[model samples]
Target: MKSTVEHLSPTRVRINVEVPFDELKPDFDRAYKKIAQQVRIPGFRPGKAPARILEARIGRAPVLDEVVNAAIPAKYQEAVVASDDVTPIGRPEIEVTEIADHERLTFTAEVDVRPEFELPELEGLTVEVDETEIGEDEVTEQLDQLRARFGTLAGVERAAQKGDYVQIDLSAAVDGTAIEEATTTGFSYEVGQGGLIDGIDEALEGMSADEEKTFTSTLVAGEYADREAEVTVKVTTVKERHLPDADDEFAQLASEFDTLDELTESLRERIGQSKRMEQAGQARDRLLEKLVEGTEVPLPESVVQAEVDSRAHDAVHAFDHDEDKFAEFLATQDKTREQFDAETREEAEKNVRYRLVLDALADREEISVGDQELTERILFQAQQYGMAPEQFVQQIQQAGQLGVIYQDVRRSKALIQAVRAATVTLPGGEVVDLSDLLGDDDADETVEEVPGEVVAESAEDVDGDAADDADTAEDKADAKA
Candidate 1:
């Protein structure tokens, strides 16, 4: 067996392979055995017929066809593994060129390959981040949040207002036809919370107990999804939350603190720590943006298209792939199909670009992900998806996506390395150090799991399933392997 590579472009390659008949003995043997089990020979038991006798009865063409079909994929994988420079990023378009009955078989495979490029010097790069300052108002807001957690709801005799909790019965109709799924009784909702429905907040305001108001809102799900409907909400009860006074007794009840002043001080410190962590996140995002903007990454068209198609598929999946319904859904967001496509393409390009750049950085730094890192990533992702770690692992393994997750973890670690190498500054021109947030070299070597953290800004967060798209592309590319 022999193989040679042809450089079709900076991001693609064509590999030509030739396998001599002697190297195809295993494939021929397997094909003959499979064919023997299906054919009946007079004096021989099932699957006991010899290859030559079976070929004589079934014809050479059938046996050769099965052999070729089985051999091509395995041989293609061999050719790929033999060539160190051919790292395919997309599925190969394979074409059998020739087959000599007793001599050799030849084929050519064209595929998208990772492009080569030099990374910019990370130590010289500089980025600006937001200032980390915890104001009194911010501390007060945190205190209010904590107090609200321990607050009690009491019945009120007045009209419902913002911040009041209301028990209401809701019913809706589209074109005078009742939507059964849209009807609910004794549903408890907070005024101004604004997530239950589109216009329920405004309809509930100023409604006294046992009062009802009819308003119009669009049903976002079910058979009447995306359709405007008349909605009637009857207020069964209205109640307001009452918080305890900020005193020593209340502080002792609410927390381990001895006094209200001590509690307020702790809240202020916690808020300050959160603000500083946010600043670290800002620094990571800014640094990544700078690196990506300054670098030149050659995009692979097939990989980008794969990502775009995946995103588009998901965008329409909720509508059962109904284009008209998807268009209507887009229209609700004031977006045209053309605009959605353009945005999808732009986002796909960015995602592919980010992946390629980080992959290159990881290679340059010789970064490697260990078993522990991979396990930690799996656990974190399982927690995010609300699945057990074993269940998540089984699902990903069944989908052949464990490698894609490994890539994600590797990319995250690479980005943390970039964050440490780059210079980050506050708005006031003071240099900011993220060593504590990023952890030391001797520590866990993982980024902090703060909200809006730097690692969260990666391409995986773009559509929250970009990794799935990448997994699909990788599965296609390495199908034979």
Candidate 2:
């Protein structure tokens, strides 16, 4: 195979490849033989047909096509690997020209190439991270939430009131047209949570058992495009919260802690974990912002158009059949569909560039996600999505999206290395702490800090109130379904 590379731009290339008749003859012979073994000539034994006869029986074009299809992929892969350019993530536009028994097989493939650029000095890269602090009120508030989680629902003797949970039968319509999707049976809602079909809460503010009420609400056509549905609500049961006593016994029953003191410390640790996650997210965003600022490449119109169409197609499908909110969304942003495509095209280019950078950075730093890291990352994602880790793994495999998950793991590893490899400088002259960004299984390294006057023990004494309350409320609310 003979190939010639043409640089269209720093970020694009055209590789024209030709298989001389001499090179293609062997492939043609193998393909012919393979076809001969399966075909029976009228007077010949199976697998004994000659190439000329087989070519005659099946036309030169069909045999040439088979040879070309089997040959292009291997040759394209070799040509890509042989060049300094990074192979594209998407398809290459391939056009075949020459196809004959004794003639060369000529084809041209246009592909996007990773832009060659200098790495901006990224050492000592720093950004201001909000100081980690556990305040007394925050700790107390957290404890109260935990207590709410442990709270039990008690039967109410009075009519349904605001903040009360009520079992309800619901029905809704649009312009007096009754719709089945607008109805539910035995739905329980906590007044003021803002989840119900509009105006249901206001109508149910003071209603006894089986009291019917009707209200009007403008459906925002947000996620559900049933516009301005008139809904009827009926209150069936009124229930009030009966919280557990916040004593040592309560602490002991709710958690591993036997005392309020232990429970408070645990809550503080949980809060710290949450704060660490936020800080890590901010750091990653900052790194991305910087990377975008430093990279330069000429993006092809085709790549951007493809990405925008893909994004728009997905957005349009999210709504009811033939109905799309993206048009409105684009309008709100002051962009025409064409303008939106142009903007998203730039975003697509950035994503492609970032991916290329990740590939290069990973190779240069030898960054890798090991089996343990993959397992932990998958489990962490499952936990984040409120899915069982093993089940989530199976689901990803079943859906054939595991490659997406693997790429996520690889990206995480690459992000860490890229940040560590760069020079970070804080705008406020204070260094950001990246201790939270390091993997848990990584060797322990003492972070630079004077222990910061020691975290106030008084603040850490707050109970696990907040988390408990959220869990409790979610449990009660979801149980009604």
Candidate 3:
């Protein structure tokens, strides 16, 4: 067998392959066995007919097609691996150019390969992120919410206010188009929860029982229409919060803390930790956005397609091939499968651009993943997946997904290095504290987000990589961790 590659472009190649008569023998024999099983010959058992006899019955073209089709993928894969080029993401379009049943086989496949790009700028670019300092008021507010969680609900004799829980039968119409028909009977929604329909919560803020009011509000756009809907909300009941007594006994009942003061102190610590984490999130997002903007690079089609395939594969895998999630996802959006596919492709394109930009920065600055850092990051991520570290490491090695792993490590290290080189400023014009951007207290919540499909290790997902490592030695460390 001989294979020669013709360069179509930096990211495209046409590999002209020639399989000689000797190499075609194995495939010819195998193809006969496969075809023999599918058809019956007179005076012969199925799959037991001689190759020559079956070929005489079926003619040579059909048998040759079977052999070529069956053997092309394996042959192409070998040729691809042997080539001195970067990896290919999507499957190739295979076509048989020439073939002879016992002579030679030839074909071509047009594939999408990773693009070539120069490193982008990633120096002292700046971004403004919200602060992490937990003011006394913020601490108190968190403490109050915690206290309220343990408190009992009670009926209020007064008018409904902001902090009250109301049970109401709500209905709405849009030029006689009823959309708010969705029932929430005995629905327990927190009044100030902004996640509910916009402006609907404010309408019930001060209303009393049995009071009905018709107000027009626009539906949240995008999936929901932007048109206005006139809603008639009737407040059936309004109940106020009855907080627990902020005393020693109550504190003991609510937590392991001995006294109300101890509980408050613990809450303060937790709240501070939470605030630090929140700021860390903002800091990370700001940093990523800045990194993307700082660098200017064009993304390749493979990069985007690779991400799209990854997402689709994960979604199907997560459902264990149930297929209902795919249907439901599209149905909810009032879209078909084609539209969803396009959306995935678009998302993949953004992901590719972001990844390329970050990588260019890493390369330009000579930043790289250390061996020790890689091992630790892998082990930590394995634990997150609830697997043993050794097992996870073995799996990563087996699947050849280590390139993806190394890229993640390089990006993270590069970002951290940039942070060290940068000078940050806060909104009040004071020099912002850079501490929160690097580390936070809730080490567990810092699970990483890798595009919309893969999750890598970061502050949010510090242990995410461990999840990928699900094998034996890995499982042991994972169990211990």
Using lDDT, give the best candidate's number: 1
TM-score, prediction 1: 0.91
TM-score for each prediction?
0.91, 0.78, 0.64
Higher-lDDT candidate among 1 and 2? 1
lDDT per residue as tens, model 1, 298-338: 98888889889988999999889999988887898999999
In candidate 3, position 40 carries an lDDT of: 91
Pairs with backbone N, CA or C atoms under 3 Å apart (clashes), candidate 1: none
Cα error, candidate 3, residue 364 (Å):
12
Q: After superposition, how far is residue 121 of candidate 2 from its true place, in Å?
A: 2.8
Best-matching candidate per TM-score: 1
Poorest 10 consecutive residues of model 3 by lDDT?
A: 457-466
Ranking by TM-score: 1, 2, 3
Model with the higher TM-score, candidate 2 or 3: 2
Which segments of candidate 2 are over 4 A away from where they belong?
A: 33-40, 45-48, 175-177, 218-225, 300-302, 320-339, 371-406, 421-428, 440-481
Worst 10 residues of 1 by lDDT: 453-462
